[model samples]
Target: MKNHIVTAFRLTIVMLAVVGIYLLIVYGGSKILPTKGNAEIITQNGQKFYANIGQEFKSEKYFHGRPSSVNYNAAGSGGSNKGPSNQEYLEIVQKRIDTLKMEHPGMENTKVPVELVTASGSGLDPDISEEGALYQVKKIAEVRHLSEEKLKELIKNQAEKPFLGILGPSKVNVLKLNIALDQLK
Candidate 1:
């Protein structure tokens, strides 16, 4: 009986430690990261969600971001949850392609990256590939009345490096690019 009691006590202690550590990590990480909120200007009312990154949509004058999902009604962070081979996924991709073509008629299908259309795991991928940025450059330039070459330069500079030397592919923060676009004039 004593042995069993000791074992139970040890297990309880371990479980408590795990819970405490998990909360610590979650709270600490949340505070440390830069999360997007409605402050980025998704709605006309200027409603803001604290630490709810990638949960809103904005306008064309500003570059748009990837699709995101929250509780849909309550606004919890989520993604499309569709796999690459899903037919629904395929249809959405096609729709996005058509839309992009409509927006920038000159951007060849080959130039547009897959990341631009497909929903990311979080549906909140704040960054797109440099190619995606370039694909939209002409349209953004025309809209902002800025030079295409200058827009390209800005996009290139905004791309984040993979690592110190090499790792992940280069990515451009859509939010940052749109902010710069607004500031360009």
Candidate 2:
């Protein structure tokens, strides 16, 4: 019994040391990031917006982000907590799909990008997959009276590449894209 107690005590010390070192490393890493790992904020037209957090954009002139389970409230960031098989979740997704179809007639018969209809694991996702942005190009171009090619080019320029070229998929920041769109005219 004494030997077991000593072994457990030693293990506890080692575990504590490991966790401490990890915390120190993480803190050091944050010190080197642009925002010091804090929220990236942007000021436009006297209004401050947290660029890292998703905002609702229902205007036809703007690009929309993922569905927000918490209505884009930063304090309540979370998924819907419903499985794909849940009837309520399915109904919500179906309604979103129907809305998209009605809004973008050009998207007829096209498979809507999954990200556009689904709430992200963190409902506050401010970015969308590259393909998701492309899917909306036609509708935006038609509404804004801009060429589709120009919109596509903007998307290409604004796309954030995958981390280290292989860690994640490419995505477009919707806020940045919409800001640029406003400046295009």
Candidate 3:
């Protein structure tokens, strides 16, 4: 009987310690880096999506991100659930291409980034391929009234390298690049 009571006490202590540690991590980290929403993000974010768009959008000097999602309520980000070869996907990509052409009137079709035409698997991707960054250089330079050389420099500086130098392709953090673009603007 005494052993049983002692075991119960030990279990309760362990559970409490774990719960306390979790709470501490949550609260302490949030305090250290407060997450807040701002202009630009039509929808708000929570803990789930680590990419912060609110801050990125507030700046206008950077190249804009891809608009590959259509969330009716922004409940949560999910893919269009369409395969690459789906007719619906083809139609969507065509529309996006049209929009891009209109926005960057002088840009050639070949210059459009693949990411700009294709929706990400998650549809809520916060990054784009490095090609996407290069594709936007001219447009960003024109919009911000900055030189192409300067914009390209920013893109190169803000872009992240491949994981371990070739495990994967290089990527650009859309949010970070946009923020940098804003600063340049």
Candidate 4:
């Protein structure tokens, strides 16, 4: 019917308009952000690294980040897809907690920060909660032979506060923190 054809044409035009407007908004928004939505590349010691993506840090002298479901592979960014109630997932987390206990002897009484044991939704998060960084201060200080107070100060300095003062939790970018730690004497 002619009416049906006209209706389909009108709907198609509306859908196209909506999609175009959305894309324009996204492009415009990206222009205001740092690097214009491109990955932030960082250079150190003749090595190039993407500052926005998570990197593995297993040394006791450096802060650790959240576990990666995709093994920190940016090409496969995703969570483990297992809920906390899942026995297998719980066991994995327990193993991590046990490992942390072994690595940091004095932290038996202190609560381990949850973010340290769980993977981010993207599984490539570069930042950790401020509490998570503080939790590892003593261990890092012992290994690095730096004063705990000084290391705490470094964590404080590296912390990125919640956006607009209340939008999200404060976090510390592990890569940046570790780089600064290495530079410390």
Candidate 5:
């Protein structure tokens, strides 16, 4: 009985030490990050916005990001929790598809990118796939009176390539892209 108690006590002390070390390492690591573990704040047109969090863009002139299940509420990040075949989810997606088609008339024949119609798992994804950004070029060019080729070039410039050139899919940060668009003369 005494030996068992001693072993348990030692185990507890070792676990505590391990946990403390892990926490220290994490805290130290955060300090080296660009934002220092804080949100990446971007100031645009005299207004500050969190670049890391998704923002709702309703205007036809701006490129839209992924759909947010929580409506871009940072305080309540979550998905819709509906399966692919859920009736309500399907209806929501259909509405998005219809809206996209209406907004971009000639795109009826082109397949809509899935990210534009579906909310991300975190409900706060600020980035959209490159294909998603390109999908809206026509409508944005029409509303903003810019050339589609220019907009396409902007997208190509803003796209972040896959890590190490071979890992993840290429994506564009919508907020950054819109800011760049505004900067275009």
Candidate 6:
């Protein structure tokens, strides 16, 4: 019994030390990042926006990010957890596809980008695939009265290339892109 008690005490101490080390490593790594582990915030027209989190942009003039299962609630970031074969999930995705077609008119025959219709695994993805952003170009151009070519150019400029130019696909941070869009005269 005494040996077991000592073993348990030693295990507890070791675990505490390990956890402390892990926390220090995470905190130190954050300091090296651009935002220092803090949320990236952007101010536009005096309105503050958290650029790191998913934001709801329902306006036709702005590009939409991935759908949030938690309704953009940072406190509860998560996915819908519905598989592709889930009937209810299918309904939801279909509805989103219908809405996209209605909003983008000429895109009725075009394949809607999957990311645009489905919530990401985290449901708080702030970046969208390049195709996702391009998919909405027509609608945004029409609503904002900007030329499609100009909007495409803006997307190209705002796109973040893959890490090391060989990892992951090129993606556009929706918040950053929209901010640039608003800046356009």
On lDDT, the leading prediction is 5
Candidate 1 per-residue lDDT, tens place, 100-140, comes to 78878677555567776766765556777888778777777
lDDT of 3 by residue, 9-75 (tens): 9999999999999998877766543242232332224423235431223233465565646431244
**Residue 172: error of model 3 in Å?**
0.9
C-alpha lDDT of candidate 4 relative to the true structure: 0.91
Decoy 1 TM-score against native = 0.71
TM-score of 5: 0.86
Task: Report per-prediction Cα RMSD to one decimal.
Answer: 4.6, 2.1, 7.8, 1.3, 2.4, 1.8
By TM-score, rank the candidates, best first.
4, 6, 2, 5, 1, 3
State the RMSD for candidate 6.
1.8
TM-score of 2: 0.89
At residue 29, give the lDDT of candidate 6: 83
Candidate 6 lDDT at 108 equals 96
* Model 4 weakest 10-residue run by lDDT: 29-38
Q: How close is candidate 4 to the true structure, as a TM-score?
A: 0.94
Tell me each candidate's TM-score. Answer: 0.71, 0.89, 0.63, 0.94, 0.86, 0.90
Model 3 / residue 116 / CA error / Å: 0.6
Question: Each candidate's lDDT (Cα)?
Answer: 0.68, 0.91, 0.66, 0.91, 0.93, 0.92
Per-residue lDDT, model 4, residue 109, is: 90
Off by over 4 Å in 4: none
Q: What tens-digit string does per-residue lDDT give for candidate 2 at 96-165?
A: 9999889888787899999999999989999999888988999999999999999999999989998667
What's the candidate order when arranged by decreasing lDDT? 5, 6, 4, 2, 1, 3
Candidate 4, residues 11-77, lDDT tens digits: the string is 9999999999999999998887657889988799999988899999977878999999999999979
Error of 2 at 184 (Å): 0.5
- Residue pairs in clash, model 3: 61-181, 61-182, 62-181, 62-182
Estimate, for each residue in 95-145, the C-alpha lDDT of model 6 and write its tens digit. 999998999989999999998999987788899988999999999999988
**Candidate 3 similarity to native, TM-score:** 0.63
